[model samples]
Target: MRRNWTDTVVAMLVATALGGCATSKDKVLPHGDHTMLDVWNQETGGSAGGGQPARQLLDARQGLRRPLIEADVQAAPANNAAYTRTAANEIYRQFHRLPNPDLVMYVLPHLAGTDPVPVPGYTTVFPLYQRVQYAMPGERLEDY
Candidate 1:
């Protein structure tokens, strides 16, 4: 009898606690005829999103933007302090890739499979090195 009383009290307490957690739907979610843009603006706290302001924004940005002239193009290379005009910076500089020797393998035609079909012989070429190596700056490479 005592156990039943305690269980009933505990169940009532739990039920009361759960019942308190039930919030009015109005309080839990926003209630109004609000557009998606209005909700987005409220959440992000940024200027409103729309195409109407794009033209004004673009026109305002145009105030700061200016077209590049020949003077601007000619001055760029001169202002660079780390590097001067060199063959390496121009067409004179060449990317000389390290040479990789070719391995020519000739497959001799022979009978294959249980049916003994004649397989025609063919020649295939492969690189001797697994990966093409690169020459370090100023590294000497001998001509083959």
Candidate 2:
């Protein structure tokens, strides 16, 4: 009986330990009001959820820079350039990363503009936001 109790306790301990390792990868994360440019700064260490790496944000920001910036936001040179780059980068980097639709929707307007594009592809008509996924242990950007 004592041996059986010891085995049961060992099994329970092992199960508990393994349970802690099971992280929810498919769970959607929160999308904050940041643009692609903001993503570069936001991803210093890891993401807000603590499960994903920060590099994803950086990559997303770089990937969408041209699309978001080229879109004409109609703001003054200073405001447009600054916000356009920042908003574009932040929104693209963090848009799809978050699980909450409310968060993504909240930042959408800020990333996009009111008017249609004056130059078609050169200007941005709709705001674009990206989603980020978590990386596994020892995983790098290429792995994803």
Candidate 3:
């Protein structure tokens, strides 16, 4: 069979052009034509009989904590009073502004078998939304 040099050259050029389109800053790329449920199932943590794999859980928690720790270090409050004062001022400003709030405070009681459980393994406090989404009612969250 005769080799098609023109077709080969065209293919190489197209490949190079496509490669150039991909930037170094791409942390994640779209998974083309996959439904949300399909992606969820693919990423579901595999059950290991009684519970999840300890190592995998620890890794996930550590991964989550890394960015938060970095942010905390960068935000380095001079003291507890300074941190509290800053947070309180932000909360007051939001309160003054009504619906648009700096923080959404939620208190959820940990329960085990229908009773409020103690912290030593029965239940623990899970703080959600330290990063507040400030938005008016009926407004899209992504708008802000």
Please tell me which predicted candidate would have the highest lDDT against the true structure: 1
lDDT scores in order: 0.76, 0.53, 0.54
Instruction: Please give, for residues 23-51, the per-residue lDDT of candidate 3 as tens digits.
Output: 56444564568777655544554332323
- Per-model TM values vs. the true structure: 0.32, 0.20, 0.19
Error of 1 at 107 (Å): 0.6
Clashes of each: 0, 19, 0
Q: Roughly what TM-score does model 3 have, to 2 decimal places?
A: 0.19
lDDT of 2 by residue, 1-144 (tens): 999999999999999999867756555455668877567544553444332455665677788877445435544476756555565676643322323232322222223357643432232333343545544433433321
Cα lDDT, model 3, residue 139: 45
Angstrom error of the Cα, residue 91, model 1: value is 4.2
Could you give candidate 1's per-residue lDDT for residues 19-75 as a string of tens digits?
A: 878867788786689888887765554366545455666677899999999999988
What is the Å distance of residue 65 in model 2 from its true position? 35
Models sorted by lDDT, best on top = 1, 3, 2
